[model samples]
Target: MRFVAKRQKEGVNVSDTHPLVEASTLIVGLAAIFAIIAVALIFVVELALYFVSAEDEANLFGDWLPDDLITVAPNDERLYQTQLLVDRLASHWPGAPYTFRVEIDDSEIANAMALPGGLIIVTQGLLNQVESENELAFVLGHELGHFRNRDHIRALGRGIVLSMFFAVVTGNDAAGIGIKAADITLRGFSRRQETRADEFGLGLVHSEYGHVDESWRLFERWNIDGSSFLDLVTYLSTHPETGDRIADMKRHAELERWPVDGEITDLSW
Candidate 1:
């Protein structure tokens, strides 16, 4: 009986030590589980952002500019001509629907924009500054490239996703979080998307009219004669850098062997 008790006491001691080992193991296991959950949550948030951004882009543009605002000036032959150019370029994308609207804003902001649902807006300032139809086509093609790749939607998605991530991580309001996300998203587009748009825009210009130099010339004109600082604040707010973008356009043109000389059509809007 005494021998059995002595062995039993030894067993109890070993069992006590076993728990220390098991406790350490349990802590490590739990930590790994938490880490996995964190990673999974991050992925889920990113995926959710992608879809949310696309939807938000559609909604935001839809709400801001109703179809009623898309008016064309009478005798605006240039506006019609711009639309025709945009249509011809967009046709290359195969079943891509686009609408061109010329917003005659005398804001001195030389800019054109493509919104979702085939909406294109060109400031009168932009029309006035462009030297030729080819340069205008280049700008329009770049905007259309954005639409073709659904870049705005992707940008919105990235913003929403990032906002959700920060909100969840920091426990902030979704609205505030979303604003921060948008700020980040607009700071700079993905390098890949920017390159793709540049290439696509160059291809369109080269294919349609063979006026690749127009792209570079347009950028030079904007740099030299674009709106003043206060005027450009709004323009640069959306379009960050002018010089670098121009450089990129030039590089892409050279790489693609686009023609250096082509007549700039005298179509002033």
Candidate 2:
């Protein structure tokens, strides 16, 4: 005898979960995985940085810098004075791997950047903003702190990891987006690094001058209310707000009982 055909149950072919729900779950899982791998890679990079000597860093990155910058003349009084400060601070850093040098870039941007090796690029605008040696020491110490912690290499390694991950996932089509994404992701890390550097710099300032003195004033001078468009943008930037950093340093000094007041040293150059 022939068997009768039977009707399929309603919704038997469909999954119990909604399509959107499945999609959302998959997306969240993937994101969690990606985050884990990225964090692991970052941790690996940080660990590797410990093994890479500072001399190795200088050798690797020294030539990447431009040699043609209109660096202040070695004989220039201002340059000489700045170098003197560097030498003094560096003396406190016994067994320092690199001999630090400050190069004054003839730019109006009020910024100081730590380059690979011991080179520090200080903008003329930053110098113009300086009111005293203590202020300048704070800036220099901040850069030195970057070097002490090997932040440049840490950042570079983290960027490479993000870029590579994105390039592989996106078939190299979304590398720019990947970089921007990395920058945004790394902003918090960068801010912490900046804060730590501030502390390191503050210590150097105190050690060299016997008082923390005017170090925090550099940030105080740059303090801006978040009302302006540009000022608001700073919230998203890598460095912490200048005012917040100043407050942090003051709090730090108070905790350490480091003297914040002393005779202000004038910058003759």
Candidate 3:
């Protein structure tokens, strides 16, 4: 009994498994648990969002625009013309839940992003890159597509999931072990979502215009062939390869029998 007590005091026998193997198994298990919790939470968030009215979404995120962004005045010529284009596009989707608003960010970043409640922000750099009204329309349509599909809300839910995951796992050194793997998975998901948005945008462009001309011109600048850093890390990117995206758009247009050529409208601004 004394020997048994001494052994008990010494703690349970060392695991037969190698220490490294045991640690790895423990880390993998914890990571799996975190992943499961995150997925469940995200599912709950999505279900909750379904019951939340569009008006409620607008009310919740109406003033959520970044404070650091300097938006062009509503009366600015560029802003005015862009708003008109958005209005024209919105007309095509009369069933959309929220009233669309356009804001031009006074920055050089060549990008556009959709926000909750039908807010679309385009950087000045994107405006600089745009060569025609049809190209610009495609961009706007893509953002509108995000709104139509509620991608922005899903993105918000994903962010919340990540935050909750990190909150629960942060203290342990192993917390960071799963981040890169998770990021790669999320990026793949994002790339697919972007492709869907692109497809939707192409359809909208075809619907609005008699043909789908110049809809893919916005991606032309990046349609180079080379094995650069970007190529090496394509899998890690949230966006798909620009050249492939353009090719896919062309193929889709072909399948739909949409004319790829038409009169391109110059941007008024």
Q: What's the lDDT of the predicted structure labeled candidate 2?
A: 0.77
What local lDDT does model 2 show for residue 34?
61
The local distance difference test score of each candidate is: 0.64, 0.77, 0.77
Pairs with backbone N, CA or C atoms under 3 Å apart (clashes), candidate 1: 53-157, 99-118
Q: Residues 1-269, candidate 2, lDDT per residue (tens digit)?
A: 99999987887877799889997786666555666666777889878887888989877766566667776666778777887898899888888888787778776656777877788878777788789999999989988999998886776776688767766777544244444554556665778898899898888999999899989775664564333334334422646777788889999999989999998999977
Greater TM-score among 1 and 2 belongs to: 2
lDDT of 1 by residue, 172-263 (tens): 44234344444444344455566677678788888788667577676676578744555456556566467888878777777777777877
How far in Å is the alpha carbon of 264 misplaced in model 1?
Answer: 2.0
TM-scores for every predicted model: 0.63, 0.76, 0.82
Residue 149 Cα positional deviation in candidate 1, in Å, after optimal superposition: 0.7
Model 3: weakest 10-residue lDDT segment is 227-236
Worst 10 residues of 1 by lDDT: 174-183
Q: After superposition, how far is residue 96 of candidate 3 from its true place, in Å?
A: 1.4
Clashing pairs in 2: none
lDDT of 2 at 249: 94
Q: State the lDDT at 166 in candidate 3.
A: 70
